[model samples]
Target chain A: MTDAELLASCHTVFPGHKARTPAQMFAAMGAWCEEHGVAHDVYGSGALLQQFEQKIAALLGFESAVFCISGTMAQVTALRLACDDRASRLVALHPTSHILVHEKSNYQLLGHFDALQAGDRHRPWSVDDLAAIPDRLGAVAMEVPMREIGGQNPSWAELEAIKAHCRQRGAHLHMDGARLWEAAAGFKRTPRDVAAGFDSAYVSLYKGIGGLGGALLAGNGPFVARAAEWFRRQGGNVIHRSPYVVAAAMQFDQRLAAMPGYFARTEWLYGELRAHPLIKPNPAAPQANMLHLHLPVSRERALGIRNHLAAQHGIWLFSRASHAALEGTSVVEIYVGDNLLDMPDGAVREALTLFSSALAA
Target chain B: MTDAELLASCHTVFPGHKARTPAQMFAAMGAWCEEHGVAHDVYGSGALLQQFEQKIAALLGFESAVFCISGTMAQVTALRLACDDRASRLVALHPTSHILVHEKSNYQLLGHFDALQAGDRHRPWSVDDLAAIPDRLGAVAMEVPMREIGGQNPSWAELEAIKAHCRQRGAHLHMDGARLWEAAAGFKRTPRDVAAGFDSAYVSLYKGIGGLGGALLAGNGPFVARAAEWFRRQGGNVIHRSPYVVAAAMQFDQRLAAMPGYFARTEWLYGELRAHPLIKPNPAAPQANMLHLHLPVSRERALGIRNHLAAQHGIWLFSRASHAALEGTSVVEIYVGDNLLDMPDGAVREALTLFSSALAA
Candidate 1:
């Protein structure tokens, strides 16, 4: 197949119509390289990396930023750095946090750190729940919009209380701000405000930012500076990460500058899904661009429908095996991005209709 | 400036030039994707990843392989895996290994694994050096064709002795085989034969093979499978590493096949350099494609000559800050690649003449 064909295939496979054009990603990077008068050493420390880091720190109102290869590595490094002195290597967090479910004990294996399970997996972590945890905690990991249960977020008041509690206990509060932009939109707050209380925050460029690959860890001067060294040591350094960085900056430039508008689009998408009898969103109201949808179909059936929508109708959505409920209902994540925002609600509704028709067939 | 100018600027700064043209890397990957016809889900247990593991295992003469983002990560992960059952998380290694100098002690902070410094820093490890380590070692790390001091490799007999020593002591043998390809050429052996004694080996796609960015950790079936799980936990899984996989296959197809011919050119280059009076290679013998040429001049003067040659004559080479007894004498590493091999001996000699003229000027 040609490059165009490969690019189209990427679009088809990506769920929620959240894919960025490869051409656009590359073109922007190439342009950036020309402008900078330096090679886009995205992997190494260079102009592109510095600009991107500063842009992200400015966007999030952090003191500094360090780019890393992955959000997982970034979080692990940040948590390890946060464990700067006292006895406990224990990180307190909601049970459904990325550290617990996704990291697969890397904190334990590589960070030599343990997790203190603080919140219920089903609900967002509240101030009261955090307060109940014992003192002497090394760090508290908070996912801005909890991913496991469909991007639900607690109130700002509750977050402030939790932050104050951590400060009182001498605990470093870390924000797993993977989708902080989405949370900012939902909360009607700035990204900086949401990330304000945390000692460190990790934001992913690929998810809502629509880049090919990359993440950033932000914190105070010493913490971020050391994190940069750790990044090089971790082999997170790449030769031409400029492509990824440029892609991120391009998408983020367009999207992040207009994130306030994303809340309205998210609401529109969520409304249409809630009206459907077969579709069930976890929270009924989404706090971000992503939401988990439950369908009364088996995992295989859901995937079949997803394939049908992509291959037959050229509409992309997602289906997952693990998120499927035991009662024969499958849960799949649907993300809203630049592509989906332009496509009419009718296109998505029609895709779902096709999905149902395929299951019936 | 143009892309070529930017690339030239980068060429002037960093050391290695083993990378393949990005277009060639991408084209090779495109072919692999077509040949495999499998969706490369870089995240979890995907088909392409499964095939990647198996193919790498077959190539490295192991039962399985785990894919990671870079060689640095692959080495650190392998060491951590080896120490899983050990009472003391101590990894024994030569002082010149990548982990000690390049990685910034990630093994200490992340893996909680300490490097028990053994072996001479200037030369390859001996059997006596391996036996002298005082710790209850979890694993003994050895780099085939150690890159730091020059791509100098141990004789096959020394390797066999080191393997026997590790086996006798009931310690795991880990190979930091980032330059295993070069080592194999030097030893007149296949990659598999060279890396056979180690419990695990980490190989880089970008260094010698000229892929975009990726590494493979090959080992026994159980260990590799577990490593794959750790890979996921560490968030090394990007949304799509298929581009990298494609680049890797492309490198394997083009470079791996062309290695035999490349080695002949490298040998010829090594012979030519050794004939120089003022210039001297550390061992005065070329083991691999790369050799360090000690120039009888200050690093400042060496760099001045190097800049003059590159900016004026388009010749590229590397110099070290400190590497030998001739105190201000700089070490220039000559790497044989497609570009350098294409340069006529007359041009090569002229470049050296230009360097000498610059020093005189």
Candidate 2:
């Protein structure tokens, strides 16, 4: 069976949030709306969306927030607004930032801004990296708990230092906080506390909140108001966003409250996987509810093992394994969420043992 | 009460499609998915979205189609792709086109293309207008049944001549067919027939179909494949589009079939209003399911009459009135859809008489 088929047949997945069928998701949203006396939003405005945006703004300690259709829309617009009036339209970011690796250089292509790589790949950029930049920058974008590099986050003090350095350089600080919920748990701080220093921050509703899909870009009132205009320019302003807003609002509190538990589970899972000879956990420890496991197996073999785990044990470990920097090794990322919390430790331990045995063979 | 509160309290509305509450929309979508055994689409790929795209492509006689989150996204992407690889990145469009009036110049600001105004703002551009442009053009964007001009469309022969002119000039012809469904009914032709000769066309699902929100862009296979990449660039690709896809799909056939009825109703309504001295209908008659009513009243007076009609009769005529070129006059656009079909003609006539008496007073 194909990987998708295998994953579909599995009863449990040891990764991010549990998957919901469209029917279940819509049913839940319908029930929530009915219970809460929800009204539809028109052209991205109404009580429902406005209330949700306000709540998110309060949570992130920003004066206002705008809900976007996607994180790509939110982040690109935030960076564009940050850089709009500056003499130099250059934004600084890590080599592995989502804007660099995943977004097809939309920040440059569509937003008309040049991006300067601040640090090498495989790790988060530091305060020194920001200070070392020779050219003037309109903004500095930092991703908390960088996903491509095993969800590693900088220390709270380091983050504060980075903020201070950006201010000193007269560059706006923007957070690509798609996984800010996880990063907040890692920092042992509230989301508002962790989001305090950045001039603007974006959070994904779907990643940790398990919404169908949406994002929130939060900042000072005027900045966010400017982002709203950018939002219209990007066609992010749709007539009805109530479905996404309702879904995100319904799942937000419960999922956010579970983040610390998920983080603890990631720590335990990292410890368990570290002892295996074939498995090397990046970062040597867990910083959030995510880790990268570098396995000394061919990509085909890794797929086979993944399928075997699903078919025989009904445990989904990872979906895709990417080429690691090391020769003859593949890396798979695991994001701990409700799936890991719901599973007993013994089941995960047994699955790991079986996976290791299969790899050894 | 606020306009929105007035809209919400009304039992019947006479313009555009019937409105559904958030709870009703989600519940209907959920029930449809359950009945059809629907699976969620992941990041703009899946059988459901693909099938819908195929159906639209077939309907439009195009090789392929891509669903977008909004009409603005679809049109901008289409125009950008049409202009790419051309020596001249100058696009020709009517001065009052959505891209010019509503999109905040996204075509120029984000798409990086210069727009040359082709025709006067009060009417649809004809073949002569296309031939009059002095510069080498990358594309000519025509809005069928131009909404800003009371749903006016060029003749089929005029459209064909425009297409030929574009071909001779090596410029792509794009149709901003947001109301193409109604345009088809007005032309007494199939959508495929109306969509012919255009290199790319965009249609809105939420406008007449009563779907929550979405759009479709149709073109040749390669062009649409390129549009999918642009869709990603614009952050239009979301994790799950099943909600929108399903809603559009469920209503597609029913609403497409009802266009003729809506158009007929619009013709009748236009005749009823054209006889009134206090009201002048743009275009002098209806070409499609939309008409603009020019009333000899101030904006506040028009709005007060609208609110009074809603409060006393539960009949919604129009939401907002824009100042007309003539002094002490405002223009209100009325889109005939399911709501009008459901309302009795006597009630509508009575409301109009009351409105006329109110204006005379």
Candidate 3:
């Protein structure tokens, strides 16, 4: 079956899904375009894009914002702009930041930026880690809810301290705020307030909004203007960004308003999952709308159980199971989204019971 | 009125417009999605993208292709792969290459690739230019129908010599094939024949195809595969590219077939314009689907005439008037497209009369 058909066929309860069904996503985008009476962006900027950028910039309390094709471009381009003409193009971040692990070392390979790894693997970068960096850095990059490690984040005060240190040291601070929507909800602060700690921030449009993929790099006007140039050089300046921009604008409000609810449900669901004998919640309590669920089952058994759940009950769960698979433990990453919200009460308990029985098979 | 309404009202000829109406584009995309029975790409690869990539790779006679958000990313990423493990990250190209003039020096700034000028300002790079570089290099980038100099390109033999020189010197050859579709018809070469000269080539989707924006970096399997990883890190690995990919697929065949027709139309249009007392073709002969129409008029009056054409006769023409505007010479760049072909017979003569009258204003 086609991917769209497959996704539509399964009744999924996974939070990591950043998009709805393809048909639904496009339909809503078409509707949004009609209602706004706006044209698609020509080359990264137009009425639809301008409005989208303004809304995001205002939400994050930045002077300006530039839309890009992906968060990788946004972050790299932002850091590149930050390092412009600096004697040192050094940056420090948690070792697991997307650039370090997922980007194929582009910061060093393509961007020629040196990265200093800081902080422990299991936790967010602390103020002590920031203080430990001896050199003057071009920028300090941080990700909220550090997805690699169970969506845990530093307390707001801690994050603020890190921000202050970067400022005091003449280093530009950037936020890899791909999931800042959740961070804001978790910290109970406005997005602007959460983002105020950084000189610039890269917030994702696709993840929180659950729309077509794109990102916004926000900073001061000159910085954004410069980043816009880099955006083009780097190919992030796309033509006809209507689907990404308009649909993102449409979903922004609904998703932003729903973040607190998602956060609360995350806590509730984690609480529910913890009672299971074979299940354990990393972080125990979610800092945001996603966490990791470790189960005493093999990866093969977890895959069998997930497939069984989808086939028998029409319910799709996490994408895959990991975490010490050789030791017969299955780790599933859970993202709290509308999928989880759509589940009925005690649905998780029933699904876990089935999962428990399938582990033996 | 909105930009869409304004564009709808205009009945003029211009270059650089590839998108039809936003509604039409999305409708075509939606239709393609339905026919293909697939969804948009999630993160750079999926059913829709694979089909899109395969079609371009086959058309260009390359072993593989990776879709990117724009030509800049495709070129830079392609070169990084080309320059892999090389001591020299230096490239030689036309002095007016897009990355040099438009990218704010991103190849040097972000990509760390030093560039050396290798061609005359007014012509394509020749074997002499390659010999003049006087050093080992990473790659040699050449634009087909170099847009800045009124869409002029060297004969196939000249290009072959340059390609041979690069190969002889152990340097990679790259093509900024943004207008390769136009160039193929102009040179009476197959797309594959044109692309075969380069180790890696970046062809644009939105230009000739008249589709939503995206680009393809085409090369051998491993080069494109490595470029795909770089693509993700560079932020070109976006989610939900169905609208761009499918709409482009819809446009590709028809547009590719129409290039020769467009080239002939460009000659006809340029011939007609040359008969005007005040108008002159920059190259004196059409090289591709586009050319520069230089006029002995001020930029303001040229703009006024264009606006008059749109306001009075509903014709949209040219993006801007430049080339010594202060010296009262307005150069209007023209591209032959379906929009130009849709005009009535002898329409150019009639439009010139109106343009002359408007210039008098």
Candidate 4:
């Protein structure tokens, strides 16, 4: 058999033999520009990107939007702006929020924000968790379908209550909606429905949309006007964002439409896998397009089996299968993407059988 | 004359361009990639941008370097790193330094850097000027060839003394070398010679190099290592920077070679304009590729005459002919670029004759 034919039997994050390299992405953008006759957006001056921003803002039900290069910059700038008209610089976030854990508390370090941890790491915050904080808050930030913990999200009523509390406290509610697209599917609502409560929301352009790298902060006119200056000051204001804009706009429409299907597939996998004694899916339910698959092995053994499945069976799975806090068990987060749709109907069960057989061996 | 020919005959920032629109820039990058079989830089992953970075580091003689989306981010990150290893948060800068004046004190506001203004507005900082600051300083920032007043630089010996003074006071020396390429020609030295004494330096990619947008900060390995983390924290770290990388690399070689010529042309133009009674040149002697041309006209009148010349004589100057601190005299900063070189030999003399005669009337 040919090497290419042999590889076709295995599924990967990329399609068979077509890795999405930098040159490929750039070439795609160039092709996109020519096909659409897309005019270039010069140094944040083009109409195409502004239209992209408007489409996103409208989808999310925000009055205004400004694009960003990173979610860290977007969320940080949002929180800083929320605090601008307030006396308190104190902001509230979940303990496992990406900014608190990954970015070295840069909200306080670079953005001059004082962060207060609000929720438990194992679950999404409820109204009570936010109400327990004693002092006045400048802003309250919540990750929609928090990625670190099985992509769990609060119920609609619980979320609405938290938003109400923040408003009553004269604080802005900012959504760190990095995966808002998937989260909306879990809620069985349009993205606009999910974003209705927040004073400001930051949505990522890459994670769900698969753009180069960018995010957009959505808010009212005055809020975004204040935030744009900070965006410029932070050096996130690029001269030519057309490459990012074109790529993001092209994928945004396609992937956003497919999010519901990805979410359903994730739910189906979790349901099927939960019946096995050796296989455990966290939260006992799929909240979004992500699930934590717990294998009855150590983190190292789990990683080995994960790699083995890809190498031997050609059925690619998680790269980050890790040790669960529980003894003798490991976990991996499966974030469903468009690639998942390409797999055969029995792909998950078949993959699970191999995962279980390897651990047993 | 036809409108296109008439407009083309008058020089612009871009010779062939009515203006340098972003679409044209993007199309150029697309063409470059197709021509060179260039690869993409996915989240700073590709080697091509690093090759470009190495070229800059070697030219400036720094051990390590990192590219940033904006000079504002580069400088803020540099000063933050410089102060991290020390206790002092206070930084010394000229009163008119970009971070202070144009950015609206963002160094203090966004970066939390305390400002300690040093030196005179009219001239480059001397050893005496730096030695006069009493307090312990974390870092001292000087823009080589200060762009606002008139592109001016300290003599090599004077710069050395200022560097030594900063060293003796246990402060890091930071060079805001946004226009370092042109500044080197005025000093009659290499870029490495100019960057030798500073602990860290930043150079712009788009300003003189004609790239879309970006800047690079050069420093020692450890310093750059720390700054890189902040670069990510600040959201200046970009994925798919191939467009910027390709464009910047394409222009770097051509422009760096042409720096001396642009500087000389600026000096020549300044020398010719000084003889007129109503026309005046700031600093009396041209220092770099820029000078402030002062005329005995009000700001409003100067702007009207400036626009008239662009329309009538097919020679363009500036719209920022401002009311000088002195009454009745207006000043315009003339920043010489590649476009000026494209003008006819008699163009400057013709432009000057037109300018002086208008003021006289």
Q: Pick the candidate with the highest lDDT.
A: 2
Model no. 3, DockQ: 0.56
Model 4 residue runs over 4 Å out of place are: A1-11, A14-19, A30-46, A267-279, A306-315, A343-360, B1-20, B31-45, B239-243, B271-279, B298-315, B319-321, B327-329, B346-361
Of the candidates shown, which would achieve the greatest DockQ relative to the real structure? 2
Interface root mean square deviation per prediction: 4.7, 1.1, 1.9, 2.7
Tens digit of per-residue lDDT, candidate 2, span A1-361:
6666788898778887788888888888888899998988989889989988999999999999998999888888888878885667889989889888988768767856789998768777778888888898999899998899888887788988998888888898999999999999988899988888899999987878988888989999999998888888888888888878888999888999999999889888877886577888876778888888888987777887898789888878898889876676799988898888899888888888888998898
Clashing pairs in 4: A23-B40, A43-A239, B43-B239
Docking class of 2: medium
Across residues A84-110, which tens digit of lDDT does each residue of candidate 4 receive? 779789999899998888886677677
TM-score leader: 2
CAPRI band for model 1:
acceptable
How many Å off is the CA of A3 in candidate 3?
A: 8.3
Candidate 4 lDDT by residue in tens digits, B184-302: 98888999999998999999987778876788999998898788888888877666666677768876898889888888888777677766868777767777777777778888888
| lDDT, candidate 2, at B265 | 90
Model 1: residue A305 alpha-carbon error in angstroms: 6.0
Candidate 4 chain B, run of 10 with poorest lDDT:
B13-22
DockQ, candidate 4, vs. native dimer = 0.42
Q: What would the per-residue lDDT of candidate 3 be over residues A183-261, giving only the tens digit for each residue? A: 8888888989989968999988877787788888999999988878777777776767877877678778888899998
Residue by residue across B1-361, what tens digits does model 1's lDDT show?
A: 4334533654333234444333333334445555656454536456666776688788889988877877777777777778876666889978888888877777876654778889788888889898988678988889888877778877789889889889888788998888788778777889989877789998887767776678888999888777767776666767766556655664575677666656677777666665466777755577877777777887777866765556766665553445456676777676666756665777666666665555555
Summing lDDT over every window of 10 consecutive residues in candidate 1 chain A, give the lowest-scoring window.
A19-28
Worst 10 residues of 2 chain A by lDDT: A104-113
